[model samples]
Target: MKYFFFMLAAAPLSVCCQTLVHAQVISKSTQQAIPFATVGLVKQNNGTTTDEIGSFKIQCRSIEDSIIISAVGFKTARVAVSVVLSARKIELEENLVLLEEVSISWRNKAKPTTLNDFVHCPTNYYSVGLGTYRQVAQRFLAPRASMRLQSIRLCKMAGKATFRVRVYAMDSITGMPSTDLLSKELLINSSDKNVYIDLQENIVLPDRDFFIAVEWLFISSNEFRVKAKIDRQKISYSNYAPRLSFKKLTGIPTQNNCRMLNFNGSWQKPENYDSNHVFMIAAELGSQ
Candidate 1:
């Protein structure tokens, strides 16, 4: 299966349709605008993200359709379509939680270990859709002893689009992405095929499974219009560039090799997703 992605511009915008409702997302405490927040309806499989000024226009299908709004560093908010249309501003409370301190003894190890190294293969990558925060992630089992993350590496398909990197610890019970690992934003803008990102500071990786994901930023600089046929109808939409590289391999476990998409601000494993096309994202860990 192939993946395609589209980007929404960061601007005060409006949709011409009468069913579309315009709203703004803001912080409850400071009343500050929260940009790039995703607003979506799961059942309808429809959504849009807030623009630079924290404004967004989403199509309301029915009065009962629930809208889910989510952004990094904020608590997810859910409201019915009728409620969001009636209100001028949607306030999301900040989700502020201190990270647990992970202590690991670096016993003066010499070399750093690299995980998920990819072989030189044909160009194969994945993409996200329009008005969505699609995060492609790869999970790796942490070493028995905790280690420090040195850098992350990936292959860019094309263009020089800037993207964000996120780290999440694997949930013990559910085996899904759980706690946020990297608090600070890690943005990379590069056109080269091979990209390497250094953490700069030491980040402790707990002795559990962890996930590294790439988030697409829907801004003007990364936007490009593309024509595609959906349902046999040719449509034009904004495409985000610099997709992550992938390699096809056989006999991989169903759970080990799959892509996760963020719908309504939640990471979900979409059905019928290709499990053989593994993303070429790797992490380097060391005892520093």
Candidate 2:
């Protein structure tokens, strides 16, 4: 897993001095409107904070201005004034936990010298089936040890109105779905949705890996057309090695109601554990 820090930019204010835009920011998780979240104009200093109901009123001179909304522990969002005026509400997802920093030099030295020294040789699996629309699959591989799975985020794209997601594991060699792991369903709106799906399972030989499969259903009843993306990050420490991996998928949609996507990979560690050493692998999939 590779970790990277990102900085968000604010939106710009309008120059017309007419037409006020009222915007609301809500948490996708708690659903109890968020208060005191920061909302500001990009490239300008003008800003305001949400009130008790996670709502704010801004005076926009024109619809061309952009607005930047942010809160501690949440990912910052930038929206155009036009979008703010058109939509009655907005939701934001929480930021995934940042992986603990580890120097690269230590990891390079800790690379397993032989296949037998590898610790957690866990395999990760992911699959997507679109009803005559699209297809996708994904997987992650790593040596089992102590690790933390951070935020799992879903972003809805254009033409996609609604969708469903599930997380599960499977048998390593047979590729058969396993019910031993917990699974959850995720509902995504136009705004971002963040779900926490952390597991503390120990992966040794015989078990081989944890498989997570996501199933997506596009709601076409409302003539809804949309796409979605998934972002995941994990940090773990093994007795012999430390590793981090981040995976992201974007522009996923049902193309013909029969599309599918898949991912498969693995991680290896040395016999001796070292905290200073960290190996990272980033797996990503997105629209063309």
Candidate 3:
């Protein structure tokens, strides 16, 4: 399905009446909060994410809709919307498993250089979505059989809040983002117009291709409300701040450059993804 994004706000519309629910997600064993956990409606395409404290607020169209709470290293929790409203605290079981080891031997060659698909940066900025936990991923090709990722650079056209960064391995079968490449959370709090993230330690990039994704956190500080119409229905939805910059270019396929991950926990090619436009996110790589 095509998601909505706007460069300019249109005339405000009346907000649609919907059930606003609040809840918290926590680990079942430790009772600690699970931040940024995805809370999606079962069978419904809409949802939101928890804040750093594991708290979340989502507007529901129907109380009968079931809610799915999921995060990495945890078993997905599915509860009825009605139940969630009453419980307010959802517990997800930990599902920890060891990841297969990937060994890379890099040859000392040349100094690190920036790698990007875009030719130049433009003033054009794209709103990935107005929803929480909206993620935009860009694919990058490995220059050699193995390389060390030094850092990432993202041109923030706008925003001053916390956001999460993730690295993923390309799915051999589907060529989509599949598995997490990093072990720990890569959360960054920045109000800078230009965002640069230096990895504490360089991580090995697979010989093939990889992906870098930016996940918008659903926090009070990043709250952005806008009035818009969906499916001929008027409603106000929350869009996050720190808009990622984009520019127009040709020849590069949209699917190969960018993809979107909604609160529903699925990565898809956004209809707004045009081959002529690419997100201005780049990676720095060097030989080990």
Best by lDDT: 3
Clashing pairs in 1: 5-128
* Number of colliding residue pairs in each model: 1, 52, 2
Q: What does candidate 1's lDDT look like per residue over 1-288, in tens digits?
A: 244443333112234223677899999999999877767776554576677899987665566677888777778888887887889689998877522222223233333688887656347655655544467778886565578877777876767877777788877776678777785557566777777776666678885478888877655666666676668987676666657777767784555544365655556665655666667887878873
- Scanning candidate 3 in windows of ten residues, the lowest lDDT window is 8-17
Q: Alpha carbon lDDT of residue 273, candidate 3?
A: 50
RMSD of each: 5.9, 19.1, 6.1
- Taking the tens digit of each residue's C-alpha lDDT, what string does model 3 give over 1-288? 122354222222114327888999998999999887777775555666788799988776688788888776688888898888889999999877622222222333333677773444567655534332367888888778578887777876545767777888888776778877776567777776666666656778775588999877656687677677679998766566657777666764544467777556678776645665667888888887
Q: In model 3, which regions exceed 4 Å deviation?
A: 1-18, 72-75, 95-111, 117-121, 130-133, 225-238, 250-255
Model 1 off-target regions past 4 Å?
Answer: 1-18, 97-111, 119-122, 131-133, 228-237, 250-255
Q: Candidate 2: misplaced stretches above 4 Å?
A: 1-16, 97-288
lDDT of 2 by residue, 129-148 (tens): 11111112223333442222
Provide the TM-score for each candidate, comma-separated. Answer: 0.78, 0.29, 0.78
lDDT of each: 0.68, 0.37, 0.70
On a 0 to 100 scale, what is the lDDT of residue 76 in model 2?
72
